[model samples]
Target: MTTETKPLALTVNGRPVGPVDVPEGLMMQDFLHEYLNLTGSRMGCGQGICHACTVIVEGEGGALREMRTCITGAHWFAGRTVVTVEGHARHDAKGEIVLSPVQQAFIEHFAFQCGYCTPGFVTGATVLIDRLKRKPVARAELEQVVTEALDKHICRCTGYVRYHTAVRDLILATPGLVSG
Candidate 1:
């Protein structure tokens, strides 16, 4: 018996990745871990419900959408731009890695305990921030907005308060993310 494979091509972390051959039905989580060696997205529940394997995908109108890598097929991402947890940071003039504001806030706030669900949280929070940039949210609605945004992600070891507080504080502090 022969296994069927297809060429997979995509951009990840601002780098163009291959049209390399991949086995059919391979999940994006597996592809990231095995093929690309980018293991930041953890396989928490092997189901989409947990949101632990979420990655940010650039969508129509340049909108950011969170995708569950564990349940998403690798072929679905072909020719698309995907951002894993590793993609959030940039390098400085001295080549030192700089964390995105969300990551920095999470670390400073101790938002995560085990950090298994952190990657998904970061991706989700990023999407929210990006969305707010395009259309700022009202300050009065900020708490509910943060809650709805992160409600889907499950943090088994760590509770949700810290994550919620960190993201909320970050959104509140950022100049244009929230409006009066």
Candidate 2:
């Protein structure tokens, strides 16, 4: 008896990659880590609760949402665009990588201890930032908004204060992230 494999073709990290065949029931985490060597999204709880396997998926409407890759099948992402932690950086004209503001914030605030959950936190923060950009939040409601955006992820090292602070700081530092 052999496990069946299915074809997956999707855009990842701003690059078109793969019409690769992955085994049926193969989690996107495994596909990312094993096949693509993208080890940022970790399998913390293996359940969606931890959200250590979060990745951003751009829907047809251009709305980006965080998805748990640990339980998602590779085939589910077929034809969709996904951005992992590696995709969050920008490149300068000289071809140098510039870290995204969220990534820079995390580093500035010392947001992670073991760093196992940083990727998920970063992804979630990026989504929240993007959302806020489209529909700016009020300064008064920023804390609640940040809490709601990041509540799903679990970080054993920093007690989440650092991550929360990092995100809040990022928002505050960026002009027009919130209008109040």
Candidate 3:
């Protein structure tokens, strides 16, 4: 049987990507890897449980949410704006990789070992940080709140504590995310 292809176009990492033909069954991660050469969103469990293939998608009402590319079809992201792990940082005039606050914190705290799961953790924590920015968490509730937000991401490395602490410290440092 012959595979039929359909147009797949979306904004990825602030760049407009293909309206190019892709197999209708193409997974988002595959599209990012093969079609766009953007592989920051990794391939891990492949069942969406590990969330290693998570990418941030702009959801309804302008909310930023994680979308699992391993189990999600590329077509599902058509016309939407998506942020891969590569999108989290902005480069300066000197043309260097400037890690986002979350990314930088991970390094400062030494968040990962193998780093296969770092992207997912970063994405998860980024989502939590963004959400907290809009609705500050109670200082009393901060720990539980951050834990719940990031607990779902499975890390196969020396990361949970560092990741959690990094995010917590960032939240504490940033004004308006934690209210007494």
Candidate 4:
């Protein structure tokens, strides 16, 4: 048996990565973990339905969307920009880590236990927040919005209430996330 390799290139975590060779049929999660040593994206169900392998991919229009890395091919991400859980933090002038509001909320709310699904939740919530910023959701519809955004992720430890609450609190705390 022989494995063939193909060229791949993508921007990850605000850094340019690879025009290097990756094994053909390599999943994005493998590329992130094996190739780049980025281990934040966890493999849960391996099916797209679980979404525990989700990562943020920036669209050409600059919109961010959650993608299930376990099922997605590394080649599919060529020329794309991706953000993993490790990339979710903001860096200050001194280059210290500043947690994103969503990440902060998750910590404050005790949103995870084993934390296998936290990366997906964080990425999904980040996308939701970014989307809300562009088109604010009505206060009445905020719960539904949060649900829809995070519905696909599975967290075995937390019953999802904490995650949901974290997302909700982040939305409410952030200006322009919800329409008045």
Candidate 5:
């Protein structure tokens, strides 16, 4: 006798994504990378130490929260909406590729070196920027905010300074982003 599979529904990259029957024990990272081909979220430590598998879950009231997809099960994502680096660009009114301000800032600041940890940083930073939009962080608060947003990412090449600077610069470049 064959057992029936369960369907999971989630939104990805701003689109209605799935009712795919993922196995009961499938990890979110595997479902994302292997099956869905949304590979921007890397599998660095696989145990969630590296934070390279970060993705933004769309929360209520337009909030975006960063989550480690590696240690999470596919079931955890059911009925949730997730955003990856792949969703950073969208067509503007003129049909041109418009990169989100966070993504543009990352490029302008030269935020990455080996490029492995960039996606996670970008994802986390984007969520933090959204959260801080109303409060407007000060220069002193900048470091703390950045540290909290990027505490999980582990980069051996660019080091934390550049990444911290990049996130700070992004917040500074955009008014009303960081808090005091």
Candidate 6:
């Protein structure tokens, strides 16, 4: 007799993913790093303290909410949507590629030095911008927003000032997307 395995379904980077028999206790980080080869989400702190494992779980708002893929099991992703840093420059309807505004701003501002933490920052910033769009925030609110969103990351090289500048610039560059 053959054994059947349960299937899990998730939408990743705007595409439906999986139904494969993932073993019990397979961490989301392993699924992304080993199976999917999405290496942008780094493994740091391993306990979700560093925020380097940040990845956007679809439908979350404003709070820069993310799932620590390092500790989360793949099964927990069922029926949910996830976006990684690799998806930051997704193709549009016309097949033309577009980088998320946060990514562009990061590039323009030279936000990262070692680049290890860039992915987490980008993903978090993307979520933050989305939230700010719904509820505009002021300039004074910008520091707090950036601080809270990037609180989880550990950038030993850049000191986080550049990342904060980049996010602030992104918001400032687009008044309609963010206030003050």
C-alpha lDDT (0 to 100) for residue 12 of candidate 1: 96
> Which residue pairs show backbone clashes in model 4?
none
Off by over 4 Å in 1: none
TM-score of each: 0.97, 0.94, 0.96, 0.96, 0.89, 0.87
Clashing pairs in 5: 136-178, 136-179, 137-178, 137-179, 137-180, 138-179
Where model 6 places Cα greater than 4 Å from the true spot, the runs are 1-5, 60-64, 91-97
| Model 4 spans > 4 angstroms off | none
- Candidate ranking (TM-score, best to worst): 1, 3, 4, 2, 5, 6
lDDT (C-alpha) at residue 10 in model 6? 91
Report how far off residue 51 is in candidate 1 (Å): 0.7
lDDT of each: 0.95, 0.91, 0.91, 0.90, 0.83, 0.81
User: Over the stretch 1-180, how does candidate 3's per-residue lDDT look in tens digits?
Assistant: 999999888898888887899999989999989888888888999998998899999888778999899999999999999999989999899998898999999999988999999889899999998898889999999999989988888988747898899999999999989988
Candidate 1 lDDT over 10-43, as tens digits, reads 9998999999999899999999999999999999
lDDT, residue 110, candidate 2: 83
Q: Model 6: per-residue lDDT, tens digit, 1-180? A: 554446778977888888777766788898888878888899987887777888988764424457888889878888888888897796889999898888888888888878887887888888888788788887677788789878777887855888898888788887676654
Best by lDDT: 1
RMSD of each: 1.0, 1.3, 1.1, 1.1, 2.2, 3.2
Q: How many clashes show up per model?
A: 0, 0, 0, 0, 6, 0
Off by over 4 Å in 3: none
Model 1: number of backbone collisions: 0
CA lDDT of 112 in candidate 4? 87
Q: What residue pairs are clashing in model 6?
A: none
Error of 2 at 172 (Å): 1.6
